[model samples]
Target: MPITSYPFDGQDTTETQYSLLFRELQDTGIADTYGGPSFQVSATGAGMTLSVQPGFAILRGHAVSSTAVETVTLPDAGTSSRQDRVVLRLDPAANSIGLAVLQGPDIGQTQTDTGIYEMSLAIITVDANVTAIDAGKVFDERRYAGSHVGIWTTNLRPVHPRRGRLGCNTTTGRWEYWTGTAWTDLIPGTADNTTRWNGYTLTVSTSTPSGTPSPDRIWIQPTS
Candidate 1:
């Protein structure tokens, strides 16, 4: 077994050592703020050019960042609509970081392969014979660390929340968790079986209420 340690006085550090350090600190993905978009990609509003805003990302444990806007010129579209992915790629063999495109089919979803340590930033759909790209043609696909406990509004939440994943629901202003079946409230008292509008006092009971509905009261029964 080979054991490695570093950072002593007058120590000589190499690229391998730095990569190991980065991999340990963060997972491979675009760095994101809680519930916020990361490494935004947008069309320059003309031509086939796109602009990737400055952002930090990790690929295969190697950290890469763009301090200024990076531009990419896409190839002309084919006869049919084509989906092209913009990726931040790290080629460990060449010790290089390249902004590249992965061409996709007109009918199927684009495949993102991690074997090459690439983090996809966006997907652009080019119509046949289209000369200009617009904001509507681009879709942002940047992903953050799965273990990250990010806060998100209902509309901005991840498309699929996995089991035991924790997130803050800005819409309800409550913490929620995925329980392998549904998103249940993390806080005690109110739960997944319950719903209320505008934080109105919701009275939960084992049986239905007998009296007429009160304008100020909301009643809900927990599922059997």
Candidate 2:
């Protein structure tokens, strides 16, 4: 007669008592095989969401939330500015995640030189085991100078005069004669300091010249 097979119910079936053992052995005839720990979740689903955490670390990296996208503002400094929004992604071949500025409103449109320019979310990689790395902290805008200006002068002598020379008053629009290297407030009307003969003509020189000197004459010119 053929053997009868019993149906499997919720009751314990150990009473039937037929032991079965299946083992996978290596070519060296070893019973134990080498294998890594099993994971319940796949590598693609391993990434976790993170928010604005202080200080960068292997576990807690900066990530962009759906509600809040990282933004950088640059004021007009008479040039174009730029802002990069880098995204971190897994690289299986490299065994480490990498950072790339993925999507944004025209990275090239950001001003290159401007007031209060910002570069937000530059990326940094951590390790292979980690799935994703977060964005870097926002760096404030730094001013770069394109041009500058400074005071310049052509006069080599001091503003104050000595001997019979007249001193220049930077405050008032008048030149006063120096009384022994010191400025005299008085304005001499007709005072002769020296006399000379020019082409058999008597020419008197005063502490202050009356009119513009000849082109070859040595005299200090007023400056702006």
Candidate 3:
């Protein structure tokens, strides 16, 4: 039989697989940093000066973690109020990553090109002949796009499960709560002990169960 699997020993991983892994872990967007939104965009002054707060983001398979605040200076406002977008761009050809402001009349329009990944941080409204860009003018457009925070499907559970980590088993169509031990069914009276994947036995309980980790474990497999 022909076997096509990812993340095997001595197997070279591709960017597409890395993207899938990242998507499985978290969504492609800004993650909370220091108990607040990461990569916050705000106006530094009235004269086209903008400030981006340090933050972290998972763009596709790439992880961007910035500790120093970045300053971006935009051009002077035009005669009419126009919309501009601040974005974090990823260029695969140049193998570089940087920030740029897409200034135009359209609102929330970001860069969309082949091999170039970009995400909008904020949308700022530049008024006609405005000298000051107030906080009200700068709208926070950061998207929290993590779908894997507390969600999982069959064969997609965390390899090293952590305490208080909750997930849903989509294969069984049930919200499974991982109580740092077994996969407990959050819905009342539902038993998932019969649910099996990759030949691994999973402990399912209808009621809340607490104990040490089970011997039966779910191993990671190809997600094709």
Top TM-score hit = 1
Task: List, residue by residue over 45-129, the lDDT tens digit for candidate 2.
Answer: 2232223212211101111122232222222222222333433332333434323343323543132221112223332232333
Tens digits of per-residue lDDT, candidate 1, 177-211, equal 87767778898653644446686657778897666
RMSD after CA superposition, every candidate: 9.0, 34.7, 14.9
Scored by Cα lDDT, where does model 1 land?
A: 0.76
lDDT of each: 0.76, 0.29, 0.72
lDDT of 2 at 174: 48
Local error of candidate 2 at residue 128 (angstroms): 37
- Per-residue lDDT tens digits of candidate 3, residues 1-224? 98667888888998667766766777677776322547989888657888898887877667778899998987788899888889888776776667889887754544443477888888888889987787888888787654345677778877765444567777888777656567777775645554566666554455434555566654333344
Candidate with more favorable, higher TM-score: 1 or 3: 1
Model 3 poorest 10 in a row by lDDT: 215-224
Backbone clashes per model, in order? 0, 7, 3
| lDDT, residue 31, model 1 | 69
TM-score of each: 0.62, 0.15, 0.60
- Which pairs of residues have clashing backbones in candidate 1? none
Order of all candidates by TM-score, from best down to worst? Answer: 1, 3, 2
Q: What is the lDDT of residue 84 in candidate 3?
A: 85
Q: At residue 104, what lDDT does model 3 achieve?
A: 74
